[model samples]
Target: MVTKVVVVVVVVVVVVVVEVVVVVVVLVVVVVAVVVVTAAAAGELVKVEVVVVVVVVVVVVVVVVVVVVVVVVVVVVVVVEI
Candidate 1:
């Protein structure tokens, strides 16, 4: 029973980590593409400011997501151990 539980938890954690990484990568790519396109279409100075703002927001969001994921993984591991 313990082995099974451990295996399941490991699998779940691996999947979650992979999913989070993929999501963050996709979001970054999309955000960069959008920023670049918008900057090209709009005024340079205005769009540069907007891009900077968006990049910062994205960074914050990614950090939050990573922290949340880490917390969840730790909780799961602790629960499984118990």
Candidate 2:
């Protein structure tokens, strides 16, 4: 009876230890994956920011050119009337 009790205790301890180790390993893997995903997302955001900046700059330049042409045309009309 004592021998059987001892065997049962040993088995329970082994299962508990194995369960703890598996939980720890799973936690570590989840942390690593989260870090990788965050880094990748940050890299993609930087790429998007660069594209947005380029687009904004181009739009500003085009607007400036259009405004200047309009002003020149107005000035010509005013001068011709005078």
Candidate 3:
């Protein structure tokens, strides 16, 4: 019967729409997961860079202080000998 065919067609269309919606939802979830992971990795890299910079600065400061101390001691010794 024509009515039976129409009813079957409607059911098929409904199923297709439901399937499409589920696929879209899954895609969204995958995209969100990837973004979160990338952000976390980037944040960690920034933290490491900050730590390395701090260490370099501290080392330079310490070296400069040691050099200044050595120079002062040498100057004092020369002045005393004269």
Each model's C-alpha lDDT?
0.75, 0.59, 0.59
Estimate, for each residue in 1-82, the C-alpha lDDT of model 1 and write its tens digit: 7796778778777867886787778687967787678678676444567667877887787778767877877787778677
Give the residue spans of candidate 2 off by over 4 A: 43-82
Lowest summed lDDT window (length 10), candidate 3? 43-52
Candidate 3: tens digits of C-alpha lDDT, residues 1-82 = 5665566557556655665565566556655655676588875433545545655665566556556655665565557556
Candidate 3 residue runs with Cα over 4 Å from true position = 43-82
Would you list the clashing residue pairs of candidate 1?
Answer: none
| lDDT value, candidate 2, whole model | 0.59
Give lDDT tens digits, candidate 2, residues 1-82: 5665566557556655665565566556655665676588875533545545655665566556556655665565557556
All-Cα superposition RMSD per candidate: 3.5, 34.4, 36.0
Backbone clash tally for model 2? 0
